[model samples]
Target: MTDVPAHVHEFDWPDRVVIGTVGLPGSRTFYLQARTGRRIVSITLEKEQSALLAEKIDEILDRLREVEGNRYSVPTSTPVELVDNDPLDTVEEQFRAGTLGIGWDPTTAQIILEAHPLPADLDEAEEFDAAASVNSEMLRVKMPVGTARAFTQRTREVVDAGRPLCTLCGHPIDPDGHTCIIPES
Candidate 1:
C-alpha cells in the first residue's frame, strides 16, 4: 500500500518466473527466480516455503475461478505451452527470503508474489513485515493467471523431486538411510 521502494526488484509480467534449485535432493537449496528480458533476479528460499508458495498460489487461482462470471481466465491446470521443465538459468543469491507475500490484482488479473530478505536481528524476524514499506530490498513479481498456474505446477514438481517420503511414518527418506519409527498408539 506504499510507494514502490527503490530497493524493490519489481517484475511486471516477467518473461519467465519459476522456483528452481541447486545441489542434490536432500541438501538442495531452493530459489525463486524471475526474468524480464535479460534482467534476472534470484532469491534463496526454503524447500517448505517453495512448496507452500505453490499451494497458496493454486488456491488463489481456484478461488478466482469460482467467481460468478469466471472472467479472470484462471486456468484449471498449467497450459501445455507455458510448462517450463528446464533447469535454473544460473545460481545467484540476491538475498535469503525470511518472509513472503502473495495476493491478487483484480485490475490486471495478475497474481503478485513478494519475497523479503531475512532480518538482521534474528529475534526481530517474526516482526518484520514483507508488505510494509520498509527500507529493505525485496523481489516482487506479477504474472498472469496462466503463468501463475504454470509456476505452481513447476514448483510442486521441484519440491516433490526431493527426498522420497516413507510410507509408514510419512517422513522423508534420506539418501543414506531412513528408519521409520512409529509412535505409540
Candidate 2:
C-alpha cells in the first residue's frame, strides 16, 4: 500500500467536518459535522438519497445565495412522523452489524463510512479475515479525493505539535526513546 501522502493530517473536533459514503449500493455519501462536541452530529447526505436530499440541499444553497454572502441559515434536520419503524434505529442496526465500515480521521475530525459486505459470523476467523482485507482495500481506493486539502492542513498542525505518543505505551517520548517493552525472541 502506498503511504498516505505527507499532506494527510489529523483533525480537531468541532471545527472539522467528516465526509464518507454508506449503504449497500455505495450510492450514499454522508457529510457529518460535529456540533457542541461529537455527541451531537449534524449529517448532510449527498448523492445517496438522490432526489429528496438533492432538493433539500439545493433549497438551502438557494436561500443562502439570496443573502448575498457565503453564509446562510438552514434547518439541520426535519422531523418525520413514522408509523411504526424508526429510520435512525434501522441505520444504527446496520452499522452495528458491520454492514457499514466507519473510518474516522482524527486529525481532520472527519468520518468516512461505506456500505460493505461483512462476515457472516464474528466467530468465523477465516471469513472475518477476508472481509476485513476487502474492507481495507475499499477504504484506500474509495477515500474521497476532495478531503485531501483539509487533511493536509490538519496534518501540518499536528506535525508542528510534534511526534505522536507511543501506540504501545501511550506515553509521549522523544523519538530515540520509543522502544516497545515487548521482548523479541
Per-candidate Cα RMSD to the true structure, in Å, reads: 2.2, 17.7
Tens-digit lDDT string for candidate 1 (31-137): 99999888889999999899999999999999999999999988899999999998898767888888889999999999999888877676855676655534568
lDDT of 1: 0.90
Model 1 regions more than 4 Å off? 1-6, 123-133
Question: Judged by lDDT against the true structure, how good is candidate 2?
Answer: 0.34
- Tens-place lDDT digits, model 2, residues 3-91: 33222122233333333334432233343332233333333433333233224333433444465443322223321321112112112
Q: Between which residue pairs do clashes occur in model 2?
A: 9-155, 10-107, 10-108, 11-106, 11-107, 11-108, 11-109, 18-110
TM-score of model number 2: 0.22
In candidate 1 the C-alpha lDDT for residue 131 amounts to 51
Q: Model 1, clash count?
A: 0
Please give the distance, in angstroms, between residue 76's alpha carbon in candidate 1 and its true position after superposition. Answer: 0.7
